[model samples]
Target: MFLNTILNSIIQIIFFAALPFIWWLLSARKRIPFTQWIGLKPWKDRSTHLGVWIAGISAAFTAVGLALLFAFQGTETAVSVFSGRGIQAVPAVAVYAVLNTSFPEELLFRGFLLKRLQAQFGFVAANITQSLLFGLLHGALFLGTAGVGKTVLLVLFTAAIAWFMGYINEQKADGSILPSWIIHAVSNLVSGLCAAYGVL
Candidate 1:
């Protein structure tokens, strides 16, 4: 299971990291605007204070919510959660998660997917579509065909997170993906620490 998780993580990272280049090529060939494809907006003048606060608090809430849920389900022990294993693994997991997980995932899901969907559908529809796919991508955790309840809960939680992130993206003046990326990275880092300690 561990090996499978690692492999899947690697594959997803590679796929998403390459997505921008792939879209660039297609845009060049078809004469589509790259911004339309990738949602690359130059930074606009806007108050970033609210964004920073929302990103921070939302991320904290997400981490706490997930941890509490897992604890309630008895999938993890609280004492071990804050102990040696977590402390040892967090730094490494955080670095890798930021580079490989958060950045690429946001680029692919919020940048690319949201833009493409918005072009075809309206903003609302695009948000919903992206959120749904984001949830499904997390269903990879259910690879073994067992743990149906856990899988379903994860999917639902992922979808909720995606929705919140999408809303954040929409609210930004420049449509920057940075706030969502930060939140996603922090949440993943926390989760990875918890996992390393059998907390989640």
Candidate 2:
């Protein structure tokens, strides 16, 4: 099971990282930077984008705090960690989670998927659709380990967070995904630390 999981993750990472380039090549589109196409463009309105980024960070934390308060009665959700494994694995996992998991997920869901969906459907539909997919993907991954109820809650929480990211990403005129990526990477890093310390 562990090997299968690892292999699956590796496959997903490779697939996501390569998908945009593959599409570009096959479509024979005009020369455009991949980052822009993937919604990683430079910020146009610096102050406005920064303001929205700050507001997004605040809102995300507030929502998470409130959800935890109400759902768990102000208690920390118990987190499972590597039991017999040494602390050596913590840093490695933390780096991989932030770099591989967080970045790629943002690129795929918030960047590629969200933009494509927006072009097809409106912004709101795209945001919601991507968020739902993000949530279900995560929830399904941990279903066996976290069980039904916790996984359901996790799915809801992740979906909410994904929506926040999508909203922030679209707030920019160029649809920059940098702010959302920053937030996600930091969040994943912190979560990884908490898990390492068994404080999640």
Candidate 3:
């Protein structure tokens, strides 16, 4: 299980981290700026600053809610999904995961994909599409168990969360991914801790 988890994590990291570069190369034919595809910009507005705090708090509550929901419902699969690894080892892996999982995943799903798709398709369409893809990415975790339904629910829940965060990132109109990053990191950290301690 540990080996499988580690391998899965590595693959996920590589896949997401390479996404921007892959998309950039493909979209380069159309002359789209790399920054636009990567969602890079300067943070010049106060709203972006405010968003950091708001999103952070929202992430905290969201983590708590997810933990409680999984715990009360006796969903062992959901609780154990991301737990086996030791927290002390997280830092070493986190440096890579932060870039690969957090930043690039957000950049690909929320930044490049969501923004570009939204321009071509409306807001609702973009949100739903990206959210579904986000959910599908976790399909492997739900294999061979009744956890599939719970996994889908969790993914949909996360999708809704991502939609809101994506909106904030877009509205900020600045280069700062700080708000969303903070929210994502905190939410994951809290969720992992809770699950590890069996509090979830």
Candidate 4:
């Protein structure tokens, strides 16, 4: 199971990281630079200012996620993933969740996929498409064991959060993904802590 988990994490990271480039090559005709397309450039403020906002947003996001975890009765499953592992395993898990899960997922869904969809569809459609995709990805993670109802709720909640993230990114004329990425990472950390402590 441990090996399986490691392999799965690695595969997800690779797949998400490479998916944007592959899509750009096959589908995108315009000569958009990858960094610009992915919102790697600066936005309204410095990273320090953005980091402050992200901390607040992430705190709220994580609270909602934790509430949903209990509402969905996902405590058992959530805890099991990191339960028996020693406390020493926590920092590693946190790092993995942020770097492998949150960062890659945001890059794929919000950064790459949203931008690509916006090019074809309008902003509304792009936002909805990305949210749906984001929800579907969460569905894969929470649905199998949680059953349809709870999983659906989780998906919708996540999609709504994604929409908010997208909205925030577009609030300024020049979009930056750093804030969303930070929020995503922080949310995962919060959830991981809850699971580790059996706080659901």
Residues 1-200, candidate 4, lDDT per residue (tens digit)?
34554676688778887978777667553877777777777676655765666666787778778788678663355435765455655775676566757777878887887777887897789988899889888877866677898878888888988887776676632567777877887787767766666565
Q: Go through the candidates in order and give each one's C-alpha lDDT.
A: 0.66, 0.68, 0.60, 0.73
For candidate 3, give the lDDT of residue 167: 61
Count clashing residue pairs per candidate.
0, 0, 1, 0
Superposition-based RMSD of candidate 1 using all C-alpha atoms, in angstroms: 5.0
- For candidate 3, the 10 contiguous residues with the lowest summed lDDT are 91-100
Query: Quick one: ranking by lDDT, best first?
Result: 4, 2, 1, 3
Q: What is the lDDT of residue 181 in candidate 3?
A: 60
Error at 32, model 1, angstroms: 9.5
* Distance from true location, Cα of 92 in model 4, Å: 1.5
Query: How would you encode candidate 3's per-residue C-alpha lDDT over 1-200 as one tens digit per residue?
Result: 34554566567756765766786788674786766556765556755576665566576546744654563354444335545455643543344334435665676787667776887997778877876787666544553453666666656666666766676666664534555665665565555555555455
Model 1 stretches astray by more than 4 angstroms = 1-13, 28-49, 68-87, 143-146, 196-200
* Candidate 2 lDDT, 1-200, residue by residue in tens: 23443555577667786876677566535777777788777667767757767566756744563454345432333223332234654655555455656677888998888988998999999999999999999778767766688778978988988888888778654688877877776665454454555443
Lowest summed lDDT across 10 adjacent residues in model 4 is found at 74-83
Which pairs of residues clash in candidate 1, taking residues 3 or more apart in a chain or in different chains?
Answer: none
Model 2 alpha-carbon miss at residue 12, Å: 5.2
